[model samples]
Target chain A: MKFAFLILLTASMALAVDKIKLVSTTTDLAWAAQQVAGVHAEVRSLLNGTENPHFVDTVPEFIRLVGEAHIVCLVGMELEIGWMPKVLSRSGNAQVQPGGKGYCEVGSAVTPLEKPTGAIDRSMGDIHPAGNPHFWLSPKALAQASTAIRDALVRVDPQHLADYTKNQQALAKSLEDLHQKNMARLAPALAKLKGPAVIEYHKEFTYFFDAYGIKSFGSIEEKPGIPPSAGRIAEIAVAAQSAGVKLTLAGEYAPSKTLERFSELSGIKAERLATSIQPKGKNKGYIEFQNSLVETVLAALSLN
Target chain B: MLKNRSLLILFSLVCFSQAARPEAAGTGLQISVAGDIVGNFLGTADNRLLPREGEVVLYAPIDQTWDGALNLAAHNEDGEYKFEIHELTIGSSRLIPRSRFKVGQYFLGVGRLNQTHRHDWPFTSAPKVQTQFLYEEGVNDTGAEYSYLWPTPFYLDLTLGITNGWTFGHTHDEGKGPVLPTHYLRLVTYNDLFLDGGLQTGLNYLGRKDSSGNNTSLFGLDLTAKWREAQTLTFLFQSELWYRIYSPAAGDVENTIGFYAYPQYGFSPSWSLGVRVDGYSVLNSKDAGGNNVGSFDYGLVPTFSYKASEFSTIRASYGVKGRLSQGAVSNTEHFLELQAVFILGSHPAHDF
Candidate 1:
C-alpha cells in the first residue's frame, strides 16, 4: 500500500510540471520563442543555421518533432511553404494545424518588402510573390515578430500571460537599442558611399541595407535563385562599375568562382556572410548574428 | 441631412462586406505538374521523342479538418498516348490523436520506392526486381489507410490499409474484381545516425486472393539512409528486398524473391553519381523433364545526374542484364538511357 501511494504521488508531480512544447521552422524564431517562454516551455528549431530555407529536405524527424508540439512557429509568406505544409500534414497533431489556436506565423507582424505588385511566374526564377521572407535580418522586424509570438503563447498558455508579456517587452527593448547603436556607428561610413553602395548575390540583405540606409545597385545573379551566365555577369560588372558600386556581398553557399570573376571584372572586393546564426558555433544568438553582418560589411567596404 | 444618412449607410455596407468575407488569404488550389522524357539507345527505342509520364496534380484544403488531391497522369504506350486517373485522395491528420487517415485511391505504403512518385526518383529507371514482382512503376488502387505514430523514445509508425483488388499490375482494360480485397500492414522506424545523418527502415506485408481462388502474399523490407554536410547530400543508400508466395488452387506452390541496392555519392551540390544492382530468382520452376529447377537473373546500372535547379534535372544511365538458366548464362542485354524531368509549379515535398 505504501509503494502504490509513492507511485501515485510521483505520477501527479510529473503531470503538474509538464511544459509546453514549441517548434519553429528557423533558428532565429526559436531563439525568440525561447526568450519569451523561458523556463516555461521547450523550444526546438527544424533547420540549423547553414541550410537554405528555400529548399529543405522533408525529413521524418521533423514530423516527429511537430507531432508532439503544442505550438508550431514558422516564418510565413511562402518562406517555408516548400516543406512546412508537408510536415504539418503528416504530424497528426490537431493543435498545430492551420486555423488552430497553436498555429503561429510570426511573419504576419512585419510589413514585408518587395511584395510583387503584378502577375508573377517562374520566369522570374523561384520568387516569393508575397514578399522577401528574410525579414529577420532587420532588427525592427524581429521585434515585431517577437510580439506576435508572445500573443500566440498567451493564447495557448493563458496561465502564464503576465510572464510572457513582460519578457516580450524586455526583448523588444533590447532589439530596438541594438538597432539604434548600429545605425549610429555606421552613419559616417554610409555618408561616404557613392550613389549605390553594394552589389549583392541575392536579395537576402534587402531589409538589412534598408535599415542602414545603404543603396544596392544590382545583384550578381540576373534572376533570383538562378545561376547567371558569364555574359550576364559581365554585363553586371559594367553596370556596377558605372554605378560606382563599392562592394559585392554573398552568402557562403553561393558559387565562389562566380563571385570571384565578378569581383575581378568590377575591381571590387567580395565578402561572404553567414545568412543565419550558428547557435552551436561562433554566432550563438540573434544579437551576435546582426553584429557579425554589420562587422563583415564594414570590413568589406574598407571602413573598419 | 439626407445626404449624410446615405453616406453612412454606404460606409456600413462596405464594412459588412469586408467582415463577411469567409475565405482566408492565400487559400487557393495548389497546382503542380511534372513530366519525364526518356530516350534509349543500344536497344529497341521509341521512334520519336515522347514523355514516359506526364502528371498534373491539384491539391487544396477542403475545410479545417480535411484536404483533397487529384492526380491526372498521361503516358505514351505503343507509340500512343494514354491518360488515366492516377490518384484521388482525401486525408486528414487532425481527425485523431497521433493518427492520420486517407481514403480514396493512392499508392500502398509498402516498399521504399512503391509509394514515391516515379518522377521524383533519384535514378532514371526502376529495378528489374520491382518490375517483375510489382508493376513497372507501382501498385495504385482504391484504398483507405490509417497510420499511427507510437509515443516512443524513437520514431515508430504503423500503417494499416485495405484496397479494392480489381486487377493486379499495370493494365488498361477493366477486369472482374478479386475474390478478396488487398490488405497491407507496414511498420517503419527512423533513427539519427549522426549530427547530419539519418536512417529509416521499414517492414511491410501485403496479401490478396484473386478471382481464381489463388492467394498472393508479399513481404518486404526497405532501408534508406542519407548523410549531409553543409546543406549538401554527401551520401545516400537505399535498398529493398521482397519475397512473394504464390499459392495456386491446383498446382505446386511457388515462391519468388528479389532485391535492389542503390548507393549514391554527391560530387558537388548539383552533381551526383549512383549505381544500382538488382537480383531476382524464382525458387521453384520446371524444366522439360519436369525437374524442380530455379531461375535467377541480375542487372547492374550506373547513373549520373546533374540538377540545374529544384525545377529541372538531367540524368544518364547505362544498364546491363544477365539471365541465368540452370547454372548457365542464357542471355544478356545492354542499354543506354537518358532522361529529363521537369516540374512546372508548386512541387510537393517528396517523402523521406
Candidate 2:
C-alpha cells in the first residue's frame, strides 16, 4: 500500500508538471505566449488570422478554452471590446478574470498611439478611446509584450520561472537579429522613402507605419470603423493625389472594393498586407509573419 | 408631472453622485453612455410624421467585480411627453463562486428578447406578440438575479431570480406593501456550429401571484444562430416562443401563447436587411363575470439598417399589424419608423 501511494503521488506530480494551458485573444499574443512559455505551456488563440479581432464572436469554444487556461493574455486597450467581455463573463474562470493574477494585458506593457483627447463620441467612428491596439506590428512593442507574458507565466507557474526567462531572452535576441537584418536589406528603400507620404484603408497600420518611419497621408475611411462613403473617398483620393502619395496600403482582410476605389481615384498602387500569422501554411509562426510584413512594406515602397 | 419631475431629479442625482466620486477615475472603473432617437411616420389614422422616442443609458463599473447601469427614456404619446426609468441595476460577480448576483430593477430573464435593450432590438419596434402579452417594454421588473455557470464541458448557464410582482400585470394597492414575489428561472447553453458560426438556446420560466391571490406563470424558449465570414457577410436566425397560464379567483384557467422569429442577412459591414414575424393569441380568457374576452394579434415587420460605425446605427422599418379582438371585426394597421442609435464613452461589448 505504501509503494502504491508513492507511485500515485509521483504520477500526479508528473501530470501537474505537464504543459500549462495559455489562452490569448489574438493570434499575435498567442505566438508570443508560446515563445515565452516554450515547452512549459500550450498556447491557443481565440481568434484566427483570417478573422477580424475587433468583431470576434463569443463562441462556446472561447469559454471552454478560457475555463481551462492557467493564464489569459489579451491585447487590451479595448481591442477585443466587442466580444472579450462576454467571453470572460461566461468563462467562469476566476484565474482569467479581470484583476486576477493570471490575467495579462500585453498592450499595457507598451506605450500606445492614437489615444483620443477631450469628449469622444460615435461621430469619431469606432475608435479605441484608450489607444490604438495594433502594437503587435511593432517589434519593440512585441518584445515588451513577450516579456510581459514571461512575467505573467512565471507568476502562474513559478516552478518554470527559469525556463520562461531563458525562452523570453532567446525570443528577444532572435527578434533583434531579424530587425537588424531587415534594416540592412531595406536601407536603400528606407532612405528613398524617408517620411514618404502614403494612404491607407484603415487606422490599423499606425504602429507598423510609425516603426518604419512612413508618413500616413490619410485613410480611406472618414472615421475608424465607418465604411468609406463615396464623397469621403473622393475627398481622400484627391488629397492623396495632391500630396503625391504613390501607394495605398490595406489589410488583407479589408474590403476589396474600398481599396480598389481608393487606388483607382488616387492613381496609386494598392497592396494588401497580412495582419496576423496564419494558423496553417508557411506563415504559421510569429517570425515568418513579421518578416513577411517587413518584406511587403519594403517591396511596396521600393516600387515608389 | 410631479412624478416625472421627481424621476428627472433622481436621474440627475445618480449622475452627479457618480461624477463626484474620486474612485470613478480609478483603474477598472469603466463608464459608458449611449443614446437612441427615433422618428416615426404613421400611415394609420394619425397619418403624420413626428419624433417618437428618445432614450439614454449609463453604465458604470464600481469595481472589478461590481457594475451598475441606469436607463431613462422619454417618448411622445398623442402629443404628451411621457418619461420613465427603464432600468436601474447593480450587479456583482463576487458573491458566489462561478456566479453573478444582480439587484434592483431591470429586464426580467424571461426570454431572450425580454433581456435585450429596446434600442438593441434588431427590428425598429417591439414584436406584436411581446407588446400584446408582456407589455410594450417587455417584462421589466424590480428583482434580484443569481446566475451560476455550471461546470460542464459545454457552455451551460443557469439563472434564478425573484422580483416584485407589481409590474407583471398584477393589481396591488399602496397599503398592501409587498404582496407576492415573482419567481424566475432560466437555462442557457451555447455551442459552436458549422462554417464558423454559433448557436445559443435558452429556456426560461416565470411564476407570479397577484394581490387577489391569482396565479400566473410564463414559459419561454429561444434560439439564436449566427454565421459570419470575415467582414463581408453575416447571417442570423433568431426565434422565441412564450406561453402563459393565468388562474383567477373565479374564472377558469386561461392560456396565452405567442412567438416571434427574426432572420437577418448582412451583405456588407454597413448594410443589413431583416424580417420579423410575430403572433399572439389568448384562449378562455374571461372577466370577473366569466364573459369570454379572448383576442388575437399578429404582425410582420421588415427592416433595413445601416451601421455607420461600431457605435452608431440607423434603421428603417415598416410594420403591418392585424388584430381580432372579441366582438369586433379584424383590422389592419401599418406604420413606418426610422431610428438612430449612438454610443459614447466606454461601453462594454455584448455577447454573440
Q: Which one wins on lDDT?
A: 1
Model 2 DockQ, alpha carbons vs. true complex: 0.48
Which candidate should be chosen as best, given DockQ against the real structure? 2
For candidate 2, write residues B1-352 as lDDT tens digits: 7576957766785775577454555535444445666776775545454555555566656776777877766666668656667678998654455777789988887677788766677777777657755676677778798888777778788889998776573112332323567888999988778887889999988887777878888888999899977664489998889898988778678798999999999989879999998888887767688788788788888999998665678999888888778657477878888888876555666766
lDDT string, candidate 2, A234-277, tens digits:
88888888887777878777888878887888888888877888
B250-336: candidate 1 lDDT, tens digit per residue: 887889999999999987667999999999998887878989878789989999999877778899999898888877986688888
Q: Which candidate number would show the highest TM-score if scored against the true structure?
A: 1
Clashing pairs in 1: none
iRMS per model, in Å, is 1.8, 2.2
lDDT, candidate 1, at A274 = 75
True contacts kept of 1: 0.52
Which stretches of model 1 miss by more than 4 angstroms?
A1-17, A241-244, B1-27, B229-232, B290-292
DockQ of predicted model 1: 0.44
